[model samples]
Target: MRYGMAIDTKKCVGCSDCVVACQTENNVPHGYSRDWIAETVEGTYPDLAMEIRSERCNHCDNTPCVRTCPTGASHVTEGGIVKVTHEECIGCGACIESCPYDARYFHPDGYVDKCTFCDHRVKNGQDPACVSVCPTHCMYFGDLDDPNSEVSKKVATRKTKVLAPEAGTKPQIFYLI
Candidate 1:
């Protein structure tokens, strides 16, 4: 099963609840974040359009991070969740440099870290911390391979876009506009 997420940009309020929840649930360092809110405003004055989205690792099907890792630390797990095995990571930063989304970060403990879609939680049939704590309920996560899954349905039925699609990573996260 390929896991994925569909985030409704229109529904997101840029409150950053998802970012805080990801940090708290993942025990990420105080200065670092696994996910963040990105806002883009276009047009002029009253005609301006704003889009706010929670961004993180795309868990790409064609992962440059996994390919660039010298130590094989960066890898895709079941459900296409890209993860770094801290013990195997050599703090080389290859994966960080390869990620088009700028999702990977060098940890204080000398390892690379990023979002996992909260794989531990997903394995237990729970949503990712970011998805679960979104006050607007704009985030939907599930197996993308399952046509009936919420994430799959949302992507199929909505005008959605993936980050850096030209990079051809085949990113799993969809931003529903």
Candidate 2:
């Protein structure tokens, strides 16, 4: 089944709890983020509004990173999750350069790094780290194919957007923009 995440930006409180949880759960390398938040402030002084986005691997359907990886170490799972194999990677940094979302990282261990949607946890019947620990309950995770699922329900009922639609990546992560 295809799985993805949909995050409600309105409910996000700019808390870093999700970030710290993902870092610990995935064993993501230090000095770099597997998941991070970005913000854009708009309008005049009195009408200021902050747009906060929690971003990671876009897990594009037409992933440039997957196509650019010489060793085939960076690829997408059937569930629409992008993963980089630390051991198989040559650390050529090609994927890092090719990723439009700035998702990939070249670790100090001489291998490529990126988010895997906490695959280990998912395989163990757990939600992705970020989803499980989001303090505001803004992040939702479920099978996109299941119409009755929470994620699908949100998609059907709300307005959402994916990052970099012009890139033709068809990202799995959606935002309530």
Candidate 3:
């Protein structure tokens, strides 16, 4: 099954709850964000507008991280989550540099780290930590291939965009742009 996210940028309040939830749930180290918000400034003065985007691993079907992992640590799960075998990781940081969106980061243990879409929770039949904790309900997670799922319906009815589509990564993540 293809998995992806539907993020409502307009509803996003720039709150960092999603970031903290991911870090806490995954035991991600302090000072490193597995997923986080980015702000872009536009207009000026009274007309200034801030765009908030919650970013993580896109879990691209054609993932560059998986391709560049020399030791074969990073790969896609059957559910479409980009996952890394921490023990097999050699702290090479190839994945970090490969991400076109600057989504990946180096963990304290030197392994490349990014969002797993909370595979641990998904495996347990739960939503991703970030999606579960989002107060504004800005994030939606579900099987992208299922026509009845919210994610699939939203992508079908609305125009959505992913970061760096030019990379040809075929990212499953979508934004309600």
Clashing residue pairs, backbone N/CA/C < 3 A, model 1: none
Model 2: residue 103 alpha-carbon error in angstroms: 0.8
Best by TM-score: 1
| TM-score, cand. 3 | 0.93
Per-residue CA lDDT of model 2 for 59-119, tens digit only, reads: 7788899899999998878688888877789988888888889987777788988888888
TM-score of each: 0.98, 0.95, 0.93
**RMSD for each model, in Å, please?**
0.7, 1.2, 1.4
Question: Order of all candidates by TM-score, from best down to worst?
Answer: 1, 2, 3
What tens digits encode model 1's per-residue C-alpha lDDT throughout 1-177? 999999999899999999999999999999899999899999999999989999999999999999999989888999899999999999988888888889999999999999999999998999999999989999999999999999999999999999999999999999999
Candidate 3 per-residue lDDT over residues 1-177, each given as its tens digit: 888999988888889999999989999898888888988889979999877889888889888888898999998888788888888999888888788878888787777788889887888888999999999998989999899998889889888888889999998889887
Q: How many residue pairs clash in each candidate?
A: 0, 0, 0
Q: Give candidate 3 regions above 4 Å deviation.
A: 44-49
Q: Of 1 and 3, which scores higher on lDDT?
A: 1
Whose lDDT is greatest here?
A: 1
| lDDT-best of 2 and 3 | 3
Clashing pairs in 2: none
Order the candidate numbers by lDDT, best to worst. 1, 3, 2
